[model samples]
Target: MPAAGSSLGKEVASSGDDLSKRLDRLEELVRSIAGDLRDVKQQQQGLGVAVLRLENRPKSPADNNAEVSANGVGATAEVA
Candidate 1:
């Protein structure tokens, strides 16, 4: 029932709204990825701190035995 010009105008407006919605969704996804990266960075820092502490601690005889095993050479394996 609408005039041809008005119908064309309505289609353009609808397409603009769809584009706006898609852009908003893309922005939301980018923000989510940034937040996830922050979380991963924090976890990596925490792990680094824990590893440093372990490395600085004095090693007991039990730890020495485990360290040898950690190098992939089991107690039963011959060493050069």
Candidate 2:
């Protein structure tokens, strides 16, 4: 009947609106997560640079002596 068809049409329209709203919310969440991932990647790059600098820095004689003692090798040798 006409009344039944009208009710079904209204239901379909309401469902479509609900789906659109949910899709909008999903898009916002995806954007926020992408921004967060970019920040984390930048921080990781900074840490990598700092680690590389430390690794390339020269070691003092005392540091060398300590490392030698820890490894139980050349413990008696003078560092000069």
Candidate 3:
């Protein structure tokens, strides 16, 4: 029969190896999550710039006329 001390030592060594493998897997997952976060941040910045450009763009001719009428600009008198 194997000594009790030898069996306990083997169990401890096996547990240590399992723990090391789990830590390595956790590190890989963290790296993957960090990369995904960076991609999302970059895409968000691009979307912000696109929204700003749209907001600052010139209005179409019909839209301009509607705005002018709404603001009572360039009104003319009607002939009887």
Candidate 4:
């Protein structure tokens, strides 16, 4: 017959192993989320830079004429 204390010891060791495995999985999930957040922030920063470049770009002839018209001023359209 097995000793009573041996069964209890086995159960305690099994529970500890299960707890360790769950903790490892939780740590992996946290690392994955942190990586994803870094990627999103990088993409967001690129998008902002693109928007700034567009906003600071030189205006074309058509854009200039449009702005003049929007201000209720008469603009002569140049024949290209």
- Predicted structure with the largest TM-score when compared to the true one: 2
Error of 3 at 35 (Å): 0.8
lDDT per residue as tens, model 4, 1-80? 46878998999999999999999999999999999999999999999999999999999999988998999799677899
> What C-alpha lDDT does candidate 4 achieve relative to the native structure?
0.95
* Highest lDDT against the true fold, candidate: 2
Candidate 1 on 1-80: residue-level lDDT in tens?
Answer: 56998999999999999999999999999999999999999999999999999999999999988888899766685689
Superposed by TM-score, candidate 3 places the C-alpha of residue 51 at a distance from the truth, in angstroms, of 0.3
Global lDDT scores for all candidate models: 0.94, 0.96, 0.96, 0.95
Q: Give the Å error, residue 19, model 3.
A: 0.5
Instruction: Work out the TM-score per prediction.
Output: 0.74, 0.83, 0.72, 0.77
For model 4, name the residue pairs that clash: none
Instruction: Tell me the spans in candidate 4 whose CA falls farther than 4 Å from its real position.
Output: 69-80
Per-residue lDDT of model 3, residues 1-80, tens digit only: 56998999999999999999999999999999999999999999999999999989998899889988999998888999
Better of 1 and 2 by TM-score: 2
Question: Where in model 2 is the C-alpha error above 4 Å?
Answer: 76-80
Count: clashes, candidate 1: 0
Rank all candidate structures by their TM-score, best first, as comma-separated numbers: 2, 4, 1, 3
Model 4 TM-score, 2 decimals? 0.77
